[model samples]
Target: MADGETPIFPALGAMAPDFDMPASRGRQVSLASMRGRPFILYFYPKANTPGCTTEACGFQEALAALGGTGIPVIGVSRDPMKAIESFADKQGLDFPLASDVTGAVTESYGVWGEKRLYGRTYMGIERATFLIDAEGRLVRAWRNVKVPGHVAEVMQAARAAA
Candidate 1:
């Protein structure tokens, strides 16, 4: 680890950083292109991992409610498109899954930071989600998230915000 690199967190109510990254659907998705529609932006550690798959499936199961609240879900991970595509197909996840190969987007969102495993420290994406309003403001956020019932909370937040 660097001697003086401090961690950062995303500020509440701030506009999320605009990003253009590859999606599992064989195209690039930019936040700006999704203007006028609210979205649920979530970042997971990796694709096909147990927790990440559960989170993705949870969102998949709640798509109707999410969409009903006029919010669409987007999952992000530092995986290649091939891996993401397989994960989506295996989990039946309809939400768009973006690949942040360069990790720039994740770092910008403050999700990529120091992580620990068995007393070893490293850098990785922290499970997180942000509910963005149509005007591009952060309406709600969950950082270092727990997988269980997280999507449901997001759905509720979306409805309440709407």
Candidate 2:
């Protein structure tokens, strides 16, 4: 979905694509390790940018509430490991930030796609979020997400699913 193709994320109730990727703070996250626990996978266009910063901080602020409810969250972007590290440190983000440098994960999630800015068409990752149940099936998805109050919405749905 990165070049003029229609965006299509994994269907609800379908198994999420498995992945083992490097994360910030010298950590690694894999779908296999996440079995039997619900988690959030959010994709953003870049690291340390305005929108991304707001979104990441929003998640950081809500982590306490989400953690008590047993839902973990991971932020993903096509940035290099260094960038993610810097961003997390600057933003005080306590959650994992996965680097999808190859764009494989973004493509599988259908969040990487064409975009137009200033009348110039280009490829980028769409701001999207996927809520995966403990069974590894996606229960909900928010494509082209608007940052304001998005994490609250996710928390509400996650509480219900959990």
Best by lDDT: 2
Q: Candidate 2, overall lDDT?
A: 0.91
- Tens-digit lDDT string for candidate 2 (125-150): 99999999888898899988999889
Q: Alpha-carbon error at 36 in model 2, in Å?
A: 0.9
Index of the highest-TM-score prediction:
2
Tell me each candidate's TM-score.
0.92, 0.94
* lDDT (Cα) of model 1: 0.86
Model 1, C-alpha of 159: deviation from truth (Å): 0.7
In model 2, the runs with Cα more than 4 Å from the true position are 1-7
Off by over 4 Å in 1: 1-7
- Lowest summed lDDT across 10 adjacent residues in model 2 is found at 1-10
**Per-residue lDDT for 86-151 in model 1, tens only?**
998888887789999999999888899899999999989999999888878777889989998888
